[model samples]
Target: MTPTHETPTTPPPSGPVASAEDVELLAALGYEQRFDRKVSLWGNFALGFVYLSPLVGVLSLFAVGLSTAGGPSVFWIVLIGLGQLLVALVFGEIVSQFPLAGGLYQWARRLWNGRYAWFTAWTYICCITIGITSTALFSSDFVASLFGGTAQHPGVASTPLQRLLIAVAVTAVCLVCNSFGTRVLALISKIGLAAELIGIVLVGLYLLLFQRRNPVSIFFHGSSASHPGSYFAAFVAASLVGLFLYYGFEACGEIAEEVPNPARSIPKAMQLTVVVGGLAALLAFAGYALAAPDLEAVLTGSDTNPIPAILQSSVGTVGTKLILLVALTSFIAGVMSQQAAASRIVFSFARDEMFPGARIFSRVTSRYRVPRNALLAVNVAPLLIFVFVYFSPDSLVRIAAFQVLAGYAAFQMVVLAALRMRLKGWRPAGAWSLGRYGFAVNVAALVYGVLAMILLAAPTGDPNASFADRWIALIGFLVVSAVGLVYLLTAKPDRKSTAPEGDALEIAQRLRDRAASAASAERSEA
Candidate 1:
């Protein structure tokens, strides 16, 4: 049965009343059906990796490696990794209970009530939309890198018009890919994950077998002058970047309505995705650190294409080509994944009349069973933002990064709030349970997230830092805050839906049965 067909008594308790417009919007978006439960827990986990695009993490690592004020410290990297794990635990708890496409926005509405929820959701939409621009910009840079030089190279057409054109092309391609359907996107993500894994392994093997270096010592002893003064600061900053790397894993929960046995599969997928992706990132960082030549040069290089430089120095010409290919594949895959997640978020918003063009944007294609128009809307907005950034030239990369980090920070806040409410006797029924530790985990993540936001806003010691860094962070926050204000002024409080006592009991029983079945299956397999 479709999600729409299945009567879920667990709706928001206090929000805008469901008017005809809301019902029409939901119906138009294919909300009448739940997703087919064909996705197993493992498949959902794999899908998360595909959604995250491991290649993006590698690229971010390279960027962090080259940053004037960051990198050269494995301690920072490790700290960031832990921070993300904390944040993911918080998200896992909220999403497992309320697995829906609206993501943080939806959770915020249900937990916070009235305008606060609207503002939170609106901020989330804005952040994700900005993130779409960031992904497009990155994909364009990767494409430009293929032409004999880096995107930053003067010879490689750094002109505003050229960059804008590239961004548009990449965004258009992403839109087309996402318009097909979720299953196709999932398949593509799976293929991308495989390629990314192979590429990492290949690079690691070359570094290990040929470069006769002590991996342990390299990890333990190296220091970069560019890294910040305190391990605490480095940890905070690196965690911000690492959190970005792990951003898209929640896509599984966003599409929970479409998945079979979503309450179970979604949470399982989220956990596995983080664990697997985190391990892969750890290995990749270790290999890159061990294989790097002149750590100072790689860290200090002005070029954005530092990964190629590292591979060329360590593995020769053939290795550089392989690394480039891996980068191209990973980048394109990342763009595709971003498009899918962004579309779903927008569709969810439209279903509740949070956006303009609610009629068109929420409509699902009859043939495709996807929100085709909403996908188009999501893709187009970011493409325009990319163009704006590209033409501004000076502000593109930093602005993109600022927007993404800000959005992520906001989402983290919503998750923290939801967990807090749940702890205060507001629990939702689901297959996954945080047990007694949910509150502690949520608090840790909130603390870490707030610190990371502050660090991101602070200026690096480098004199040549872009204005984009400072202004983008400031403006992004203001924009979200402004939206929040509007929500407070215009939104109305309404009754929230709670699971009927009977339905809640039934759900609990079903969850118990499913757990028992899963345990039995595991034992049998063992």
Candidate 2:
């Protein structure tokens, strides 16, 4: 017979070589996956609302009260808002270009080296896991408040065991909701966000139009016991606290992989969320500043229940009830959003073989196409941490706060890495580029992020705090990271295969041929 086309009998490449090709194929497949762009956009925006609640803005006002206990000054609080805006812009720039599911971790990897990327992702996972726990604790506190019980009650707040039980219950409910699917989460978020906005608007309007208070002068100019030092220091401290209100825009970046046209959509969604959110926060702060009763009383009240005190003082029983109800909705929305983002982050890490039990964690459920295993991991890990809260209630709040702050710090560091890339002429093409202003915006964000971390770490005028209480948060973070470090060091890289590479090249060629053929057909018809 004429020379027959002999099929290659050689074996395919194995191990690392085979693995690399699989990864490339997976990436290409991801490019073909589609999501409803509008639903994705609104889902993201609603998620943003769930992320930033009017109640948190109210909490920021309490921070203002704490900072200015010696006097009244809204200037500093407003400046804090400005600082957050700058940071938001920097985040917008980076996430716009690289809207992947791994978020800051992926950004760190692409901008810096692979080794550092593992640590960044690890820190992010810990921060978010702890954050979910903290949100659950806060949700428990809010639920308990609805029943006229303070978080510090002997049965609830006084004993770590009691608090942990409450935390477990709340965590269970949130985990269930998250496991249901994104559509359910999105629906809950929309309802929760609407209730929160209405409550804030009603409360603010009542404060502004119905209640009569001291002239604006008191808010702009006054002094009290907590403000014994320089006004600047007080304002700076308050700004740090206020910045917490602007903390969750990065939630958008975490879900980027699920969004259609993510590179364009993520940046726009983020920018809109922050700008709109900042304005809303500003309005709420104005309402509080204008209607504040006794600044000292507001600051010194049980930190857990400051809003109740303010509402009771300003608008009587009815207003306080309304505020409580709205605050509950806000917390619920927050829990839902936290679970969604945290689960996605965990899933992304697992998909990359960065997490233990990756095969299970990375598997998407055939029923819902959701990462059920990852969701379970996200939910269970925190419940275990909540168990510790049962034994150490005093440390729970601080631990949660520290974990969230650490995550933010890690995110900021990655943004700084991207900024360095820009300096090195590694310009990425994208619809959401910062253009000429990227450098300045990133610098401001980095400075603000670093300063906030320092202030948060420093003692809050409290001495004699036990080591277990103060350092437990950092210890938890370090432990999680240590585990990730060991995994990254020992895990073998997956190999690539030439067959898959050849297959990809052939597929690409077929696509090009089809396009060319279509163009020729159209010309003939014309």
Candidate 3:
């Protein structure tokens, strides 16, 4: 099948492209370095940081965490941060080797086969598509509050229809910001990083130092430890708080072609996102929990969303609005970054002719040196889902609940594939590597993934809850997986494309051959 506009088969004649090593490595991994390599190590870290968007994660889930595990909830960030870092370490090795676009999908295909990759990519596309939709929709509350539509519901829309309209505008703005190029994406990341630092770190510090009503002791033992189900159950019930905070790290590698030294830069960025972002989130949670005027109300779930109240009390009305502004930008950043990552996956699929409209979506426009069609395509589905968003006003939290679990399922698919290859004596051969520690890290990452999935998918044990609320993650995952299966069987897209599929050793061999060929050409030119 022909691409509607040809995807660049070689770097352009009269412009900057990826570094010589980056170009060779990308060639080895079965893609042209079409995107201009503009993302520095800091920019890469910024993308992961903003995409992880600590303020958005902590603020969105803080009340729920407080309600569930009380003071002990803060520790989950540390616990899950450590677990996700293990996953990132394993990812660091794989991405350092392949450094391909589409992150998890590209790694899975190269480590295993195109069929496995097909399902993996399909699952990932669905997960991220749903994931960003929820994010964009969730931002509506902030948007509504800024406009002074309803005082009774401070940070939420007065009606579902109002929310749908607000959310549509947010998604539209994000898409417009995304279309400019990688530089814009990097700039947005930096902006988001600044906003987050202020929103989480600065706000948390002030709250902890000056406005604390309760002592620091509550972080160790909040009042809810003595519930009927016990502290362990409460801890497990509130697991989503930690799961949500550490996610944006893997996004560092999604645009591998856009960074100069992806193999090294991306791993560092992923690790930093988990570590720095984790600490920031912990501080924010602690500050808010300690500063709450009615701590018992938050713990008992009477104050369902206590963040605005906490901010207003401690920082006053103007300060609260300023923080809300920061939170709004963080939300926008999360949606934009997620959309950018998903578009790369879309482009990768289309480049392989694995997507339905490969002819169109595969094209990287010559002007911006980015995948223009694929980026636009990312928002099209989410636009349609606004109808559903209008009906389910709390759709953001609901879908977020499911995607975190589904996200783990997608992440573990690559980890499992890598582990299988490792068992067969294949080792990572990226510019950055885990060395002798690679296999150990891979094993540990898989263990963490499995544990996280179990914890995330476990029932919340609220009998009054609807069946969908209790089992949403499991049900949503099964439905998405089933749909992908039907398409894989019917469409059989993987068989039609000749994209490379092999174990890591085979991939490494391709890298060596490509590097040698590129070097030979340079020597001849010299």
In order, candidate lDDTs are 0.60, 0.61, 0.83
Q: Write the per-residue lDDT of candidate 1 for residues 235-273, one digit (tens) a residue.
A: 344444454566667767666655655655677677766
Q: Tens-digit lDDT track for model 2 on 1-526?
A: 1121112223223211113322332254232121112236767777776776646545434544544442344444455566666776776666655565667766675576555666777777777777677766766654555565432331122245555776777677777887766667777777776776676666767776766354655565545334455655554445444545666777877776566666577777776667666666655656665666554455443343355555677766665666667776777777777777877777766665566786687666543445678878877778887877777666665675567567766867786786777666654444466778878888887887777666555544323567655465455556666786676667732221011111222333443555588789999999
Supply the global lDDT for candidate 1: 0.60
* Backbone clash tally (model 2): 20
Residue 485 error for model 1, in Å? Answer: 2.5
Tens-digit lDDT track of model 3 for 272-355: 998999999989998998899889988888887677778777877677778888988888888889999999999988888889
Put the candidates in lDDT order, highest first: 3, 2, 1
How do these models rank on TM-score, best leading? Answer: 3, 1, 2
Q: How many Å off is the CA of 442 in candidate 2?
A: 2.6
TM-score of each: 0.80, 0.79, 0.93
Q: Residue 203 deviation, candidate 2, in Å?
A: 1.5
Most accurate candidate by lDDT: 3
Q: Which portions of model 2 miss their true places by more than 4 Å?
A: 1-38, 60-77, 149-162, 212-215, 221-233, 292-294, 300-304, 313-319, 463-526
Comparing 1 and 2 on TM-score, the stronger one: 1
